[model samples]
Target chain A: MSEVQRVENRELQPERAANQAAEQGWRDRAIVPPVDIFEQDDAVTILADMPGVTPESLGVEVKDHTLSIEGEIAVQMPEGVSARYADLRGSRYARYFTLGDEIDTDGIEGTIHHGVLNVRLPKRDTHRKRRIEIQAT
Target chain B: MFRDLWRANDPLFGDLGRLLRMMDSNWDNVGSADLRSAPRGSFPLLNVGETDEAYNVYVFAPGVEEQDIEISVQDNVLMLSGKRADPADDEKAAGRNWYRRERFSGEFNRAITLPDGVDADRVKASLKNGVLTISLHKRAEIQPRRIDIQAA
Candidate 1:
């Protein structure tokens, strides 16, 4: 199996980047959430595991043959409750995938449930395989 | 002879390097990055903490539903079990090319030993944004009490 390619986002404004770095501490960095890609006859499905992210906090954008997914993790702490032990803290999750022209970008659909994001990219009709029948001579 | 010796050592060095990288990756995933002690299980990463009134446990399990999860406390041990469904069979049968597959899917179970003061009967669990937050209320006798200072 081919290794998953990791891409880093480089479009963040310097000021905002600095502010985010400061807010999340130096050790906390944007993590690439694990994903599974499945191909069907007519569409490709992508599932991403992003814990602590709500539907409202997820952003999916496709531009210039690139599909980008970003999820913001909001750790809401009830008032007066402090952590005595912690493992999974809040952090941003981001990933990107390059799409081929055969994909019908306009027909793309995405849904988020239980912190899992599923994206379906339908193939263009022209790109789908068609069975040609042989004429009896 | 020297070239032959070097070639013989090449795999040994390569194996050592690979082993180191494996250890590093495991540490990154199972060690301090988790912000807790070493992981007890492999599937869902967990965080456990305690407050004055309750013990808090957070399970990071995405793509799972409350109905799919099972939680029970027995003998001061909290057991969690659930299954993460895989993609539809039709998709798999279509023979799609996979560039990468990292997400874990299948049955998983984790057992955590509760702290001494936890009140099993009062434990409450809720699923939000794919994270399971379990609150184990502390026993009334074990909860901290503020002592009143009398002015003499």
Candidate 2:
């Protein structure tokens, strides 16, 4: 029984290694940017720092209550100039978030200022916390 | 209309065109609504600190006048409120539609909870440019004291 268990372990190691490599590959292929989420008592505020996005270039879409933010950054190469630093060249950002049922889609508001996208997702009125006062006799 | 007719089948393109037109027209037509009615809260960055002498608080509120801001401290909590009104002449000015408008304006409020031992009565605030700096003196009891260790 020990020999059979050792053979099974050896066979599973390669599959596990392959799965990790595939998962890493998928992550590397993704282009979604990072977002900061702050959950408050009344609503959840999402701040997505998209540095090079212009007001005209930003796009927000809500479908099936899933919010999606898309933006493009243009890094134009100067004419008659050989490029030296090109780390941020041709970079664009896209992000999608599936909101929970507790979120009130109608109450959601979005604002874009100085390349930062601020999204306010208000919770349902019933889901919001309320204080109850008790009378002392 | 010609471009709209050309892309009538492409809803996405049509929507983009409509959005572009709206953005372009906003500069000349945006006064139909006031900033207070717009639902998004203002973004204000604040910094608070404490020292042996006093507590310090700073707020970044650019493009706002010193007269518009109000600062008060109560119950150890500092409240900063301000309103940046749009120019009255903006409503009548007409021009080619704007491609983009990104500046933020109107009422904003920020509250800071001060740690215990701060002297709220001695708090002083100053606004320069867009930065509002406040100084709060600390009570003598909260100041640190160094005691000499004697050989026993």
Candidate 3:
């Protein structure tokens, strides 16, 4: 039960007038999708559950030691279909993580399959441990 | 450890746990038409709807393949079961440390009681982009029909 701090931009909710006025235009509310993060010896992997997001609608970016992920879900209904018991609806998914210096940002790779986003951040060469040899005189 | 903080005399941490529980309850009560009566905290939340001729059930199950999912209708009860493979099982994920694990893995099952007059034999299911949609057609006798207006 390791606890990881979750940072959410609560003020970004569209319903808040004060927050909305500061933004450029109307923006969809973004929900933070649940994620599982694993730190291997050579790399760190992140798997986020972002259902409804297709590969074309998924975006992952890393800038200024920060990693950000965004996914947009397109909701479509048949012509004759109508919602009777509606609960989960299409929405935006957004999340951010602070990357450490040991991470090799250039080697980072990401993919989305079955609406899940998988990100792998490799460790820099200098960050890997190396054994020092002792000279016998 | 969090247990130590929970037992501490400080009220700040005490209030934090209480607030988290409150938020969970609030989320559970947000929706209006939850007819299944399923217990709270079920993974892969679902949405059920109906049209003139059929009922639509959508299961929000990301990262699951069609082969991993099973859907069946028996005795007017619709059952959905699926497995979300654990990412840690990947060879590249060996010898890793976990900082956070919020996404649910493993198998999950959910059952929903369907309304009468549904044609179980006509049910169809499809998985697209991780969303499993099941359409249960209604019987011909139960489908809504408009009566022709007679000229007066």
Task: Write down the RMSD of all candidates, one decimal each.
Answer: 13.6, 24.5, 12.4
Model 1, span B35-127: residue lDDT tens: 222343366877666667887778889988889999998756678999988664444445676756898788988776665767889989999
Candidates ranked by lDDT, best first?
3, 1, 2
lDDT of 1 by residue, A19-119 (tens): 55554452265768899887766888898988888878899999999999999986565555644433343378889999999999999999988888989
Off by over 4 Å in 1: A1-28, A84-89, A132-137, B1-41, B88-97
All models: lDDT? 0.72, 0.57, 0.73
Instruction: Place model 1 in a CAPRI quality band.
Output: acceptable
Tell me how each candidate scores on DockQ against the true complex.
0.28, 0.01, 0.32
Best by DockQ: 3
Give the lowest summed-lDDT range of ten residues in model 3 chain B: B1-10
Best to worst by DockQ, what's the order? 3, 1, 2
lDDT of 2: 0.57
lDDT of 3 by residue, B4-83 (tens): 11221222223233443354467545655346555444677776667788888888898888888889898677888889
- On residues A26-116, what C-alpha lDDT tens digit does candidate 2 reach at each position? 3343345446565656787666655456667778777897899887753222233222111122245688988888899888888766456
Cα deviation of B57 in candidate 2 (Å)? 1.3
